[model samples]
Target: MPVDLVPTPGAGPRVTFTGLGGAELIIGLTGQSRQMSRWALGFILIAAAGTALARRGCGSKVIFIVVVLTVASLLALWLPATTDVANGAFMAGAALVPLYILIALVQRLWNSLFVRNM
Candidate 1:
Protein backbone atom coordinates (compact mmCIF):
# COMPACT_ATOMS: atom_id res chain seq x y z
CA MET A 1 0.00 0.00 0.00
CA PRO A 2 1.69 3.21 -1.19
CA VAL A 3 0.76 6.67 0.07
CA ASP A 4 1.60 10.14 -1.23
CA LEU A 5 2.63 12.88 1.18
CA VAL A 6 1.22 16.32 0.38
CA PRO A 7 2.63 19.25 2.32
CA THR A 8 0.01 21.54 3.85
CA PRO A 9 0.53 25.26 4.48
CA GLY A 10 1.88 25.98 8.00
CA ALA A 11 1.52 22.32 8.92
CA GLY A 12 3.06 18.94 8.35
CA PRO A 13 2.42 16.83 5.29
CA ARG A 14 -0.87 14.99 4.98
CA VAL A 15 -1.21 11.50 3.56
CA THR A 16 -3.07 10.92 0.34
CA PHE A 17 -4.12 7.42 -0.60
CA THR A 18 -5.95 5.78 -3.42
CA GLY A 19 -8.75 3.70 -2.00
CA LEU A 20 -11.24 1.23 -3.39
CA GLY A 21 -12.98 2.34 -6.60
CA GLY A 22 -10.02 4.74 -7.20
CA ALA A 23 -11.28 7.32 -4.71
CA GLU A 24 -8.75 9.77 -3.30
CA LEU A 25 -8.61 10.00 0.46
CA ILE A 26 -6.64 12.72 2.18
CA ILE A 27 -5.79 12.21 5.85
CA GLY A 28 -4.79 15.38 7.66
CA LEU A 29 -1.69 14.88 9.77
CA THR A 30 -1.59 18.18 11.65
CA GLY A 31 -5.07 19.67 11.40
CA GLN A 32 -6.84 17.74 14.15
CA SER A 33 -4.41 18.05 17.07
CA ARG A 34 -6.60 20.50 18.96
CA GLN A 35 -9.89 18.70 18.41
CA MET A 36 -9.68 16.62 21.58
CA SER A 37 -8.62 19.61 23.69
CA ARG A 38 -11.90 21.40 22.97
CA TRP A 39 -13.98 18.40 23.99
CA ALA A 40 -11.71 17.77 27.00
CA LEU A 41 -12.30 21.31 28.16
CA GLY A 42 -16.03 20.82 27.90
CA PHE A 43 -15.88 17.60 29.94
CA ILE A 44 -13.63 19.22 32.51
CA LEU A 45 -16.04 22.08 32.97
CA ILE A 46 -18.96 19.70 33.29
CA ALA A 47 -17.10 17.61 35.87
CA ALA A 48 -16.15 20.66 37.90
CA ALA A 49 -19.72 21.89 37.95
CA GLY A 50 -21.06 18.45 38.76
CA THR A 51 -18.61 18.00 41.61
CA ALA A 52 -19.52 21.38 43.05
CA LEU A 53 -23.19 20.55 42.84
CA ALA A 54 -22.59 17.23 44.56
CA ARG A 55 -20.74 18.97 47.35
CA ARG A 56 -23.71 21.26 47.77
CA GLY A 57 -25.95 18.25 48.39
CA CYS A 58 -27.37 18.09 44.90
CA GLY A 59 -28.34 14.61 43.69
CA SER A 60 -25.56 13.29 41.47
CA LYS A 61 -27.62 10.58 39.78
CA VAL A 62 -30.41 13.01 38.92
CA ILE A 63 -28.01 15.65 37.71
CA PHE A 64 -26.10 13.21 35.53
CA ILE A 65 -29.25 11.77 33.98
CA VAL A 66 -30.75 15.17 33.29
CA VAL A 67 -27.59 16.64 31.82
CA VAL A 68 -26.91 13.66 29.57
CA LEU A 69 -30.48 13.50 28.31
CA THR A 70 -30.61 17.24 27.68
CA VAL A 71 -27.33 17.34 25.76
CA ALA A 72 -28.13 14.24 23.70
CA SER A 73 -31.56 15.64 22.87
CA LEU A 74 -30.05 18.93 21.79
CA LEU A 75 -27.45 17.14 19.70
CA ALA A 76 -30.14 15.05 18.07
CA LEU A 77 -32.00 18.19 17.13
CA TRP A 78 -28.92 20.04 15.92
CA LEU A 79 -27.21 17.21 14.02
CA PRO A 80 -30.11 16.66 11.65
CA ALA A 81 -29.45 20.06 10.09
CA THR A 82 -25.85 19.19 9.29
CA THR A 83 -25.99 15.59 8.06
CA ASP A 84 -28.39 12.82 7.15
CA VAL A 85 -31.45 13.93 9.08
CA ALA A 86 -32.87 10.63 10.27
CA ASN A 87 -29.60 8.84 10.90
CA GLY A 88 -28.03 11.85 12.58
CA ALA A 89 -30.99 12.25 14.89
CA PHE A 90 -31.13 8.55 15.64
CA MET A 91 -27.44 8.26 16.40
CA ALA A 92 -27.50 11.26 18.70
CA GLY A 93 -30.56 9.97 20.51
CA ALA A 94 -29.13 6.47 20.69
CA ALA A 95 -25.95 7.84 22.25
CA LEU A 96 -27.95 8.89 25.30
CA VAL A 97 -27.72 5.51 27.06
CA PRO A 98 -23.95 5.09 26.87
CA LEU A 99 -23.23 8.72 27.56
CA TYR A 100 -25.53 8.60 30.53
CA ILE A 101 -23.69 5.61 32.00
CA LEU A 102 -20.24 7.05 31.37
CA ILE A 103 -21.15 10.42 32.81
CA ALA A 104 -22.77 8.80 35.81
CA LEU A 105 -19.55 6.96 36.62
CA VAL A 106 -17.52 10.15 36.22
CA GLN A 107 -19.92 12.01 38.48
CA ARG A 108 -19.67 9.29 41.05
CA LEU A 109 -15.88 9.46 41.00
CA TRP A 110 -15.90 13.23 41.41
CA ASN A 111 -18.41 12.98 44.20
CA SER A 112 -16.40 10.32 45.93
CA LEU A 113 -13.42 12.63 46.08
CA PHE A 114 -15.27 15.83 46.97
CA VAL A 115 -18.46 14.83 48.61
CA ARG A 116 -17.72 13.28 52.03
CA ASN A 117 -21.26 12.72 53.28
CA MET A 118 -21.99 10.02 50.67
Candidate 2:
Protein backbone atom coordinates (compact mmCIF):
# COMPACT_ATOMS: atom_id res chain seq x y z
CA MET A 1 0.00 0.00 0.00
CA PRO A 2 1.54 3.28 -1.11
CA VAL A 3 0.44 6.81 -0.19
CA ASP A 4 0.33 7.72 -3.86
CA LEU A 5 -2.24 4.99 -4.36
CA VAL A 6 -4.61 6.96 -2.22
CA PRO A 7 -6.61 9.83 -3.60
CA THR A 8 -6.84 13.22 -1.95
CA PRO A 9 -10.08 14.16 -0.17
CA GLY A 10 -11.88 16.11 -2.89
CA ALA A 11 -9.76 14.59 -5.63
CA GLY A 12 -10.88 11.09 -4.74
CA PRO A 13 -12.54 9.09 -7.44
CA ARG A 14 -16.27 9.68 -7.49
CA VAL A 15 -18.42 6.97 -5.99
CA THR A 16 -22.17 6.79 -6.06
CA PHE A 17 -23.05 5.93 -2.50
CA THR A 18 -26.27 4.14 -3.19
CA GLY A 19 -28.26 3.59 -0.07
CA LEU A 20 -29.37 -0.01 0.59
CA GLY A 21 -30.70 -0.69 -2.90
CA GLY A 22 -28.25 1.71 -4.49
CA ALA A 23 -26.35 -0.34 -6.99
CA GLU A 24 -27.77 -3.76 -7.66
CA LEU A 25 -24.72 -5.95 -8.16
CA ILE A 26 -25.08 -9.70 -8.23
CA ILE A 27 -22.22 -12.10 -7.78
CA GLY A 28 -22.44 -15.89 -8.11
CA LEU A 29 -20.11 -17.44 -5.60
CA THR A 30 -19.41 -21.10 -6.19
CA GLY A 31 -18.44 -24.00 -3.86
CA GLN A 32 -20.21 -22.63 -0.79
CA SER A 33 -23.68 -23.88 -1.65
CA ARG A 34 -22.92 -27.46 -0.66
CA GLN A 35 -21.51 -26.30 2.66
CA MET A 36 -24.43 -23.96 3.22
CA SER A 37 -27.13 -26.39 2.19
CA ARG A 38 -27.86 -27.25 5.77
CA TRP A 39 -28.24 -23.61 6.61
CA ALA A 40 -30.52 -23.27 3.65
CA LEU A 41 -32.59 -26.15 4.92
CA GLY A 42 -32.58 -24.55 8.33
CA PHE A 43 -33.88 -21.36 6.78
CA ILE A 44 -36.69 -23.24 5.10
CA LEU A 45 -37.51 -24.97 8.32
CA ILE A 46 -37.57 -21.65 10.06
CA ALA A 47 -39.87 -20.27 7.40
CA ALA A 48 -42.36 -23.04 7.86
CA ALA A 49 -42.06 -22.80 11.62
CA GLY A 50 -42.27 -19.05 11.52
CA THR A 51 -45.48 -19.17 9.53
CA ALA A 52 -46.96 -21.41 12.18
CA LEU A 53 -45.63 -19.11 14.87
CA ALA A 54 -47.05 -16.12 13.06
CA ARG A 55 -50.43 -17.76 13.15
CA ARG A 56 -49.98 -18.17 16.88
CA GLY A 57 -48.36 -14.72 17.33
CA CYS A 58 -45.90 -12.59 15.44
CA GLY A 59 -42.35 -12.77 16.74
CA SER A 60 -38.92 -11.16 16.43
CA LYS A 61 -37.79 -14.06 14.30
CA VAL A 62 -39.59 -12.36 11.42
CA ILE A 63 -36.59 -10.14 10.93
CA PHE A 64 -34.38 -13.16 10.49
CA ILE A 65 -36.95 -14.68 8.16
CA VAL A 66 -37.15 -11.57 6.02
CA VAL A 67 -33.40 -11.32 5.83
CA VAL A 68 -33.13 -14.93 4.80
CA LEU A 69 -35.77 -14.54 2.11
CA THR A 70 -34.09 -11.43 0.81
CA VAL A 71 -30.77 -13.23 0.42
CA ALA A 72 -32.42 -16.11 -1.42
CA SER A 73 -34.13 -13.74 -3.81
CA LEU A 74 -31.09 -11.61 -4.56
CA LEU A 75 -29.01 -14.68 -5.13
CA ALA A 76 -31.59 -15.99 -7.55
CA LEU A 77 -31.82 -12.69 -9.39
CA TRP A 78 -28.07 -12.01 -9.48
CA LEU A 79 -26.36 -14.68 -11.54
CA PRO A 80 -28.72 -15.01 -14.44
CA ALA A 81 -29.31 -11.31 -14.87
CA THR A 82 -25.62 -10.57 -15.09
CA THR A 83 -24.69 -13.44 -17.30
CA ASP A 84 -23.19 -12.56 -20.67
CA VAL A 85 -26.16 -14.09 -22.41
CA ALA A 86 -28.58 -11.98 -20.42
CA ASN A 87 -30.81 -10.12 -22.85
CA GLY A 88 -32.25 -6.73 -22.19
CA ALA A 89 -31.89 -3.11 -23.13
CA PHE A 90 -28.54 -1.84 -24.34
CA MET A 91 -27.61 -0.59 -20.86
CA ALA A 92 -28.49 -3.85 -19.17
CA GLY A 93 -24.89 -4.79 -18.61
CA ALA A 94 -23.89 -1.36 -17.34
CA ALA A 95 -26.87 -1.16 -15.01
CA LEU A 96 -26.29 -4.72 -13.89
CA VAL A 97 -22.87 -3.81 -12.52
CA PRO A 98 -24.42 -1.93 -9.61
CA LEU A 99 -27.17 -4.50 -9.14
CA TYR A 100 -24.49 -7.12 -8.92
CA ILE A 101 -22.76 -5.14 -6.18
CA LEU A 102 -25.95 -5.16 -4.12
CA ILE A 103 -26.05 -8.92 -4.48
CA ALA A 104 -22.42 -9.13 -3.34
CA LEU A 105 -23.21 -7.14 -0.21
CA VAL A 106 -26.07 -9.45 0.66
CA GLN A 107 -23.80 -12.43 0.04
CA ARG A 108 -21.11 -10.92 2.24
CA LEU A 109 -23.61 -10.33 5.01
CA TRP A 110 -24.91 -13.86 4.69
CA ASN A 111 -21.36 -15.23 4.76
CA SER A 112 -20.54 -13.19 7.84
CA LEU A 113 -23.67 -14.38 9.58
CA PHE A 114 -22.52 -17.96 9.02
CA VAL A 115 -18.85 -17.40 9.72
CA ARG A 116 -18.33 -20.91 11.08
CA ASN A 117 -19.53 -22.45 7.86
CA MET A 118 -17.99 -19.69 5.76
Which candidate number maximizes TM-score?
Answer: 1
Spell out the clash pairs found in candidate 1. Answer: none
Q: Would you estimate the TM-scores of all the predictions?
A: 0.34, 0.24
Question: Per-residue lDDT for 41-93 in model 1, tens only?
Answer: 44455555454544333356465647654664666478633223333333433
Error of 2 at 50 (Å): 33
Clashing residue pairs in candidate 2 (N, C-alpha, C atoms within 3 angstroms): 23-98, 24-98, 24-99, 24-100, 25-98, 25-99, 25-100, 25-101, 25-102, 26-100
Task: Give per-residue CA lDDT, model 2, range 7-95, as digits (tens).
Answer: 56778667657586656554555465653554455444544554444333223444544554555455447855332222222123233
- Candidate 1 overall lDDT versus native: 0.52
Error of 2 at 46 (Å): 35
RMSD to native, candidate 2: 20.8
Per-model root-mean-square deviation over C-alphas: 12.2, 20.8
- lDDT per model vs. reference: 0.52, 0.46
